[model samples]
Target: MGIFEFVANNIYYTVPIPVYVAVLVVLLCQVFRRIFISRRPSIMESTPLAHKTSDLSHYILKSDSCPALQVTPDTTYSWRDKPQEVPREIKPGKYFLTMNIRKLDPNDYIIFDERFLSEYRERQAIIENVGPGKIFVADPSDGGALDLCEETLVVTVDFLVTRYPSMFRKTERGVFCIDAGEEYDLVTRPWSRHPLEITCLLSGEDHILIRCCDDGTLRVAAVGLVYSLNIDWRSFIGKELGSIHKDAHVPFYESALQKSVDRYFQKLPPDKLISRANWLTQVGPELRNDNFPDKYLELVSTLPGNTITPETIVNDLYIRVERQAMRKLPSTNGVVFKFRVYATNIWDLEQEEGIPRRFADHIRGLPEPILRQKHCLECADCILKAMDFMAEQQEKEKFMNSYD
Candidate 1:
């Protein structure tokens, strides 16, 4: 008999009616169960900053290595414990134009130090001297920028007050800063100022760069650069990420680094926060530097290779480091970029363990192009020689102390 005829005969003669009915009932029950589950609330989708957030694709889809990334809430920062002293993260490796990023806990997002009061005053004075338009600014036309800034400001206030209750408190009169002696009635007071400016006054960090994604492009929507850090942030507002880097004259960004950064921004999830540090050698004053690159080049050119010595290295040259963090905003689907700038003596940098050799190596590793931009070409030899002198002095002291 043919295959079709044999199967037809088996369906009628071999199979029982109860067996067909049971199979049909089982299939119908599975369909109804799935429909009920689809209507139910999911624990994973409930919270943005949950231990784990998953979509239906997580169950239905499978990747080659399905490793799950998780972030644990830090209890120490939440409880407002004093943070320990951290050594300068400045090192030899990852000094080049690269995104050296790592996980950042939400609790320890904003940093406060002994210099908070001074920094706050300095920034406010800057605002007074120069208008808020030149410092803390937002794009007037971009509605998304305002919403993103306001939402971020709200988050910042709650985060700071919760993390450091002793410093930031909520009294009968709205939020208060103990050190600054400032109070704001968030409810009744007319908010004449921009949301980013308000955020600048409340936090120890003066520089806040906000980039919001619009139509697949991430652009600088608002900037709270209260302190003068060379380039004016007002001009930076509304420029896309690519233009910002190009305007800042970040070396190799357009050529080698833009695509990588774009990919990183694309993959950044709302629940994750990442931090990185970048360093540059600066000559003269660390603050109020307008057209820093041209000025840096001019200053370096005047001091020829012959004039640099160990005595004047720290006095003339400074190692300026910036610790930056990129945080994903769940509410607005935006990214808030924050950076804290610190200038340390090059002498102090060499004093750190293994830094002398590592620092020397780092300078030599860079190509001729960046070396010229960073002014490493002008000072690298002198800096290395001075580091050697420091190293020799340390060895001599150690040998002398052996008798003791």
Candidate 2:
């Protein structure tokens, strides 16, 4: 019999309806599994989100095998507190203010660096709202007059004011809230209250302006950077500066800070010189304590150019210093510094087109360092040095193998 006819005849005689139904059910189950049970791609796999913020990808620290910033919430900033004063009332004029609130995850906020502000000058307020730190404001608006109002300001409150009083006391004369239909002539009452004004004006939109509460209130405003006064000062002093590790710690801290400063300068653009100057005053003390005044000042100086030589030196010094510090640490089991170093090196290598493919391949093939291993001070130093040496050797090999 022909194959089709024989099969048809056999099916007609032996095939059961229940058997075919069972087969159909199995196929349907598989289709359903494929539709519902498979894992979807993550945000990183998705199309790049708007690069409207600073490209922090470069700033991300990585190490051989560990994930990013896995430190527990306890070690980081707490976001559980609510603000005591919720800006219940804002009127025209200037004021000094602070909010009490939780520290948001890094992903939730945007960094408003000076370059970012210049790039999107039209949206400065918006950028400021998205940043992680405190901000300063000035108002050109004259009281509540609609035509007289200059700009609409909007500020988002995220943090809570823990120490400061929440209520506007009688002494707080410069601060007042205007009801929807209040009338005050700025020309007449400009000097009636403390000239230091805090204005909440409604032009087309609403904005809150906090003027300088006192003269020379140095507000260190920047995106990405948050003022962290709660750093483990004791741990740093003991481990990074104490007698047991003083020899290594002091030099390491100094070198690291210097490198960070150099890096800050190398990466900063010329137009941001003013902002850098402002930042230096605020962060300079911390940098000096950490032993990196040169790099810090260099960034503050605002020299022009995209040169990588200084940056390279900074990076080398940073690695050396970090390695030395790691050697003094109590333990490294969950430490992230090494992985950050490796990732940074990989990124730098990838940027150079002159690097040979074979050398790159060798680096790609090397096993990543295990981050979970409990890091003793010595172990941390060894791992960091090894990674740095490997990176350097890879670059050397790539250069040697490459054609001119």
Model 2 is weakest, by summed lDDT over 10 consecutive residues, at 320-329
Residues 64-119 of candidate 2: C-alpha lDDT, one tens digit per residue: 11122122222222222422110111111222221112233323211212222122
Model 2 misplaced stretches (Cα beyond 4 Å): 27-316, 319-404
**Most TM-score-accurate candidate:** 1
Which pairs clash inside model 1? none
User: Which one is best on lDDT?
Assistant: 1
Worst 10 residues of 1 by lDDT: 59-68
lDDT tens per residue, model 1, 1-404:
99888989788777889999999999999999999876864311312133332331232123221122232323243212343233355455435656668888665577776667777788778778888777777677765565676656656666666666677766553568877898755433234466577687777555454564645666877788754465666777778887778876777888887777766776688767788876666665445544233355555557757454433554566766667778776556667887777766667654565666666767767776666566556566776787676667766777899989
